[model samples]
Target: MLKRVERPVLKDIKDACVLMKDAAFPAPFDSRLEFSCSARGFWNIVHTGMLIPEIHQVYVCAQGCLRGVVLTAAEMNAIDRFSNIIIRENNILEGNNEDLIVEGMGEILSKLPYTPKAVLVYTSCIHHFIGCDLNLVYRRLREKYPDIEFTDCYMNPIMRKSGVTPDQLMRKQLYSLLDKQELDKKSVNIIGNNFATDDSSELVKIIRENGFTLREVPRTKTYKEYKDMGKAAINITYNPVAIEGGIYLENKLNQKHLYLPLSYGFDEIEKNLDILCENLGVQKIDFTENKKMATEAIINAKNIIGNTPIAIDYTLTIRPASLAKLLLQHGFNVVSLYVDSFIADEEDDVKWLKENYPDIKVYSTMHVKMRFVDRHSEQKILALGQKAAYFTGSNNFVNVVESGGMYGFDGIVKLCDLMIDAFLNEKDAKKLIQYKGLGCENYDTNCK
Candidate 1:
């Protein structure tokens, strides 16, 4: 007969806090109390920031249970450059190879002269089904090598729910480090340093000029360095995913946090600067020159395009929405917006669109179909990711995927020039037509 034991709810919380306090830094904020009415949501959010970055070297072990290859790809891309060694145990092509895989990984990791900062053991479906006790393995490994940091990435690939994925998992790891540290008054941590289009280094340079020290969580050197995050007066989260970590920091370290929209256009950059000045109690410097250059570039592009209908499909809704807003301001009609459903974290974006431009159409991946594309208007500007670019093709459409870092004033000018050129040239239009299979088979059509 199987024995059933009642689980202690508060015990997990207390134990997590104690363990984290010893292994990491105590969050400056009071984590004992709950913030939201929803206990489950609050705990999940708290659990999100459960790993530290200062632990030197890290070992990534997969138990072969992840559902999305994209999740692993994102994690690998994010951590690959962090001066750490990532070792994958379970092979995607080779199934039921957990023991052999784990053994091989163990051998390789054990061969290292010094202990790793952390060992992040990630599980896919195969290991989850086999009911592998990663905690036990972690404990056993710790016994053999007492100095290494150890943790589990208990991500179920089949779990298609929001707030779960490699992205969230990685964020949790960052949070754990924050919990283990002491606060730094002059220092601030940069969250959301992922493999996405986020250019944090450039932003850090701008912030440093404003007289603040910035520490990127992904670039931490030691556990002591991780603890120093608690001393920061505030945290500036660049992305929505980063917000969760900021919230954790605010709750634990009692640090003030402000969520700045991802810096794309000149306006966004100015707003970011304004917020920094206001919070840091520094004088706001004028970015008027940058703003003027951006505005002029946008205006020039608009004059060339002359009311061309543009369509944008992007991985995240914010980028497309911002692009749509910019294009609309410069006289282009954003007829269609294609976005991934996962990106919509708040309805404020939808509300903003409704208030400013009700005529523009927005389509999520869930509702998009072939009919939508067939009914597109003329002179389309397809701003999309690699995947979205591959699927979309039209005679009136110009794929503007290579605009290169569509952020800041310089990016605006480059994108505007491309759009202007695409709209004015008959040869460019013909090329687009041929690319989309809308022109003659031999590419003989003038398209004018």
Candidate 2:
């Protein structure tokens, strides 16, 4: 007779039971059993890679791991631009790993109907484990395809725990194809954004007002135009994740770079705008009307939803902590926040929340028990992001991710509008979140 083994209880949201005051500065519940949501889909590596114009991606990885990227490409209706090579058990066991990547990529290029300006060869963790000669592989590819640009990309998840993330590296790699060009003083390039800056955005409006040509990678459709990014007078990176990419541009091309990250706080936004104008050497446009509009919008939303507990989720932006502090300052009841870590920019905001709002719960959405999150709230609670909406089990949520093309003081006003609309109506979260990318025009989902 065999003895029965009892299952151990997995530590989760209920077990950790975190609150704001008790939490640390950066990571809260850093190491814990995580539960991933089925609807948890944002702009992933596949989508990120597609931003470059006239570039084909060939990923060499296991079949199981390839499914997500394959589907992502298919969903985007861009299967033609994507290819993958399956890594077999024998290939790993046997030697000659270097030949696998070089030869495999060669075959993919031969099958293509048209020539691409560049090819991103994505090698997997298996290659790293076997110590595959990546240098030899890229050198061989470059030698063979002298006319075509051969760029190295990595799909290694092991590096996620240390150093720069795979996503950060991917963004950096995209700009590597840019060769040095004569500077175009009136033109500027903004890097590391999947979505184009909205025309209505104050950032875009201000740049145009200053008589400058603003170029973003996503908006480029031609290979020449994409390469022309190297010639820009200034390279601006607004997202924190893309800071390294910005630095790479400045170092390699000697192009002036500015990091104007978005913010929820009024003071930060004003300071960022001033810095941007000063760098551009343009007179600062008066933001009196913009500030007035944002102020009015904030007041209107607060008046409508008085004392309604709001739950903040990381899906909205990287600055969820800052957003929570901003809302709390404005008298909006923010009771819960769901995130893994806080960035350096939010140090003050995190401290403010922890000290001032000690009772506010800080829950880990990744915790295994988050799947069993309490859906019932005594009052009608408002959720800010999709994950927050799903976890809180609230139908009323502002369905936007990755900033939703919102920037500058206009973004503040637009956010308030979203809050007001979310409070007034209900959305089918199950149906809406079914689409992978929020602003991404991909996905053939009928519900979308």
Candidate 3:
């Protein structure tokens, strides 16, 4: 069973204020009194991150408040330079005015000579209050337009702190397609590639080498191809954020769902290989050559940084866990682990850690107090998303903020090299130290 972390309570008002300041803006308002002013305000924030890509087209259909405006900005930021087009719908509100939204969609649909690959309809908080069933709206639109794929993004504008994350929204959209696919017994589905760090090509190579056929679901997969997904023998979930869809697939197809951590470490790769071999009933590859390569690499790495103490704070729990296991095997003292969250079959991992390295400590963000241990640790390894990297003050250590996908034997070597570099470089070490408020200048400071 996976260990669960309790949520933290807020005690610092100043920290609360800082969180609010950093939070994304609330969705737009549609009242006559605030119409012009709200539009200007929304546009300013929108312009900061909005981009028109050429591959996909976005047509904003806002209802209630200006939630559509806020969502459009975020979507635009996510798709920058991806070759997509974004066009705003003229009728942005539907009070008792459903016709406005309908007509606006019609106008946009008519203007396009060819139906787009996908059509996303965004809704505000008002739409939810008014009981607008976007699923119904999408079904209706699909029946009328037949040629285009339709989806909806629910952006609740009223609750400042309750909006759906971009990741959640994207998963919701993708689930719609995954639900329609037929199950195959020999094929395997790959979940958790958000186009952010999903190196699909490399993943495919690894999966193929392990003797399983791979299918990836994205905008690129055709409707027919996606519908045939029910055939996969099993589903390998790489990212926790993608678990929602995996759950759906399990229920619908009765396919086995295995959650694996994404990391640039040999142990993780070995675990993944083990899972594939077991599921497919295939013989394990003689890892004699691969193991030798990995062993030699670690031996070389340890010579440069023997017995160094390292700390890791990452958005994904699997990354830290996998990387920590690798480093520990290479003679590093993994003092403290700070994880954002953990979602997987942790039976093996927990057992392995307890039986072999019982002294290593793991903490979730809620219970983490990094300053207490920073003085004792010689270096830190921060394998996190950009946001978490900045939040953890890892810039003071020899840190590497990688957004690209890392997997297989080659990836493990690269991760080991990064750790070695971090251990040896004073500049990198000092940067991380300052970021975490562990510099000599603040040696007496208490973070609590």
Candidate 4:
């Protein structure tokens, strides 16, 4: 036999990133086997779907698929609102797959202590393989329980290879229960947010003070209130994942749509806020005081942290490129960006980084090569997100994901404060980043 060939595990910092100028949009790295980073900072479909009040989830998948979601509900202490129907091999051979879903749902509902306003019927990849008639399943369920509405959701991991991501699809499906409502011209609902926008943020303050009602899912107390989202005069989406859902509601309900993603850059913040003010027919916000406060906070953090090599990741803020630019402009030594792909909204920011800071490297979060990279290092690196903290071996890191709903000038100030605190403090990075869906309290005993 020929000599056995051995593939060497990658071990270099330079290998982790590309020069910013060479980075590509959507997909920067060539397709190959992927290595998953253990930073489950972003919320999954289960966490998102549960945001709706008085809604139940019934996952019709193999037991293996059910484990992850079941644990999520258990951890949140909401197992009472959750149910499942295990899809066995016999169902694929002799048993009717559609009937399993229709009948299983009926059994689940009849057992519940109280009737849910709606049910999220989730199917797995096995359903797709068997060519299950989902429309038939939904029709039968609707006919059987005319009072209880049904929304179709997915748990298919196979879809990861292509098309709209499960995250995007689940977000769109969240608003499926909303029906036509008499318009509320003074009311606005921020769509597809797992967290409410900060009360102190310019957007919230301006909207509330300007005689406009802002509705957020996290603040909705009842099922009727959640349905009233359809009556909003404006639909605002700041999260990139929620953009599709916002546009969906805009067209279907004839509400004005605004997608102002949380930005650290002052100019972008101003431009977005100005647009919002114009649409809502409110006076323009004065950001002079806000900008001054944010600038002071950044200066204070920079002085404390000095030129410590800073790393940013997409998990914290979807626009890592923009946040990196903000730090660089404020005189921070940003070393690498942990990004899998660039979002469409950050095109200009990407180009700016490419032209001005070519040496600022871009790294793929899921590249197979990342698995072999040395994680333990002596150097003190400051990581801006959980993924960056894990990959950089930085105990000193700001651990916020999805920017922690920090928005506008107040957001920038809050970011600086977090950075300062992170720099001054050291925590066990390994233990901290391992928790899935940060900001939500998880219980080991499930509130027994």
Candidate 5:
């Protein structure tokens, strides 16, 4: 049985509030778990590098470590581009694995019908533990294939505690092949997620109005196009994980960048837009129509939802606190939050929620104790995010795989529409959780 813990409202949390890394509740609730969310997998980050058309990847790790990504690649139909160098126990002890990686990559490249312009040698956590010299292997591969560029991409989970996480390091490594080029002041690069920003996003409009060409890694088809992304004068990063890469480009290539953390709150989104317009020196576009539509949609959903407790799960979003703030602002009774840790920028939202909506209890899907969460809330609640639906036992739930291309005011409108649909239609929660990709919860199965 799961027991809820009680704590003071945000104002009473402390006279001088200090941001704590762990959950507000103590013990098992605060302890983190490895419970995997069906919402995402390891390959989400892997494909960010491998999806490049002209690039081949060599994943050098143990067979056990290789299985998940191998299965995922096959599932995604991207198996043809991957070759693995499985490390054995003996190899780790003996420590001369550079030859294996270099030889394996060479053989894979030789057999390929289409010659690759670049090869990424991805090493796992075991290599770091054994202190395997991947740099040497990368250098050897570069020497062997002078025409093909080789980069050292790491999958080392051990270094995750470092200020720059493995994902952050990997995003930075994606731009390693980009050499300094003549700047294109009229061009802008969105260096971040594999997902494309919503075409209706204000950010997209601002870029176009300024007459700047937009470039994103996922949208690039050829090696030349990928390389040309470096030519952009500005980089606007949506996710914080990609901020390090933006900084690297700025310092190394003299490319200026603006880091806009993803936010679900309308106010925060508008504020981000203001900063974006100011940074790009573009006229701020009006979002009144979008705002009006979103407000109307929210009202319609709220009329049907009434006072039903809504649980917003963190797995469905990169910014759960911001989303919760948005929901609360719309007169929704957000009674439960399922989140693990808060990012630095989320502190303000967290504090505000504590101060204002203190009745909302916080839960952790990643908590080790969640294994014992058998009791569902008595309230006939509506859940947002797949994990929230799972834990809360809510029939009326919004199931989303990530943000589902949701951004800006347009996203808010779509979200309200989804909420209304969930309330009216009783979709099987099990089937919805199993479904993947953008708008997976919707009737349309063709969405990628």
Candidate 6:
């Protein structure tokens, strides 16, 4: 039987505030050893950033490091696009592993049935420790494959917290491939997250009304289409990770960028839309109708979930604190939250929640105490995100895997629908949390 955890009661939202303010939550606990119930969300980001249709990959890493990704590639049916060069122990100690990598690249280009437009070479954390000079290896590969683009991708999990994460660094490298082109003030590029925004997005409607074309990498069908994104005059980033890429484009290509971070609060969303319009020099498009629809959805959900205690997790959205604040404003009883860390950009939301809703409890997923099941609290309730459902014993939960296809007014509406559905339905949250389902159809990689 699974063990229950002791509910860490906060004196109020003020005590919850100390959790993020001073990092007093938990000790360093590794979650990799735990069996992952769902990796579909993470693979979505990988496919979005790494799996360019015309670009092939050559992954250099230890056999152990390659096992999971290799399996993932096979599952996605994208095995043909992936190649690996196993790094031996001697290679790391003696240095000079260029020959192995060059040989792998050469084998792929010469033997592949079709030509690849580019080749992305990835190295694991072993290189971080041994300091493998990849620049020289890249130069050699460039000489050998002058017709194809070569990019150095890193898969370093060790530096996830210390520096720009693998995802953030990958964003910078992806945009660096865009060749300089003539600016198009009528065009806009969506950077950062791989998922394309739904058509109902107010931001999309506003851009279309202004006669601007939206360019998103995931929606681009070909390599040429992806490259054409460089011509965009404005880069609008939805996720914080993509801000680094936007900054790079501004510095390197002189492209203008507007950061439109996703928000659940209607007022904040309106403010973000205003900022976007100002940056693009487009007239403020009226969002009153969409706002009303979103407001109605929220009201309907609130009516069904009146005073029901809730738990939210960071995996559902980027700004958990912001979402919690919004929920509290609507009179939702958010009894607990499961968050590993506070995102630097959303610190203000955390502060606001601290001051306003001081009664909500906070739990750290990575706390040393979390290693052992605390057979204590039996508070079953509605939850958002899989992790939150598990920790709170919530049977009614919204299983939003990632921030894909979620943004603007449409995002708000969909979230409201999910919350309502969870309230109306009876679900086995424990079973849902443990099921290791197949990859999502949108990002399936079927490799033999």
Model number with the top lDDT: 4
Error of 3 at 226 (Å): 5.7
- Top candidate on TM-score is 4
Taking all chains together, each candidate's TM-score versus the true structure is: 0.60, 0.93, 0.59, 0.94, 0.86, 0.86
Q: Model 1, stretches more than 4 Å misplaced?
A: 1-105, 111-116, 125-135, 162-166, 195-206, 217-233, 251-255, 263-272, 342-349, 355-359, 366-384, 394-448
Cα lDDT tens digits for candidate 3, 34-132: 101010111121221111111233433333345444344343343221122222343334343254445556777676655555555555555565665
- The 0-to-1 C-alpha lDDT of every candidate, in the order given, reads 0.48, 0.82, 0.47, 0.85, 0.73, 0.73
Tens digits of per-residue lDDT for model 1 on 1-448?
A: 9989752322122222121112211121222322211001011211122224323322333423222332322332322312222224334344434344356546756565555566555444555666555656666666766666555554453554444565555574555544535655667666553321324333454567766777654345465665677678778775666677678778877878887655445566678767867777777777777678778888877676666566665542246666666677567766766543324432444445557776654443332232233322344544333223323343433344322223455556556666666555433332332221121112221110
TM accuracy, model 5: 0.86
Give stretches of model 2 more than 4 Å off.
Answer: 1-12, 376-378, 441-448
Residue 349, model 5: Cα distance from true site in angstroms: 1.3
Is 3 or 6 the stronger prediction by lDDT? 6
The whole-model C-alpha lDDT of candidate 3 against the native structure comes to: 0.47
Give the per-residue lDDT of model 6 (tens digit) for 1-448.
Answer: 9999765743333322233334332321234333232323343324544435588877899998887677656655677888888999887777758777888778778888888888877788887787777888899998988899898887788866677888788877777678888999999988876566766788887888789989877677788888999999989887888888999999888889888888887777999999988887878868888888887888888998888878888778887888888788878888777776666756777777767776666766654444443423565488888777765656788876555567877788889899889988967666555432223332433111
Per-residue lDDT of 76 in model 3: 36
By lDDT, the better pick of 1 and 3 is 1
Root mean square deviation (Cα) for candidate 4: 3.8
RMSD (CA, Å), each prediction: 16.1, 3.8, 12.8, 3.8, 6.1, 4.7
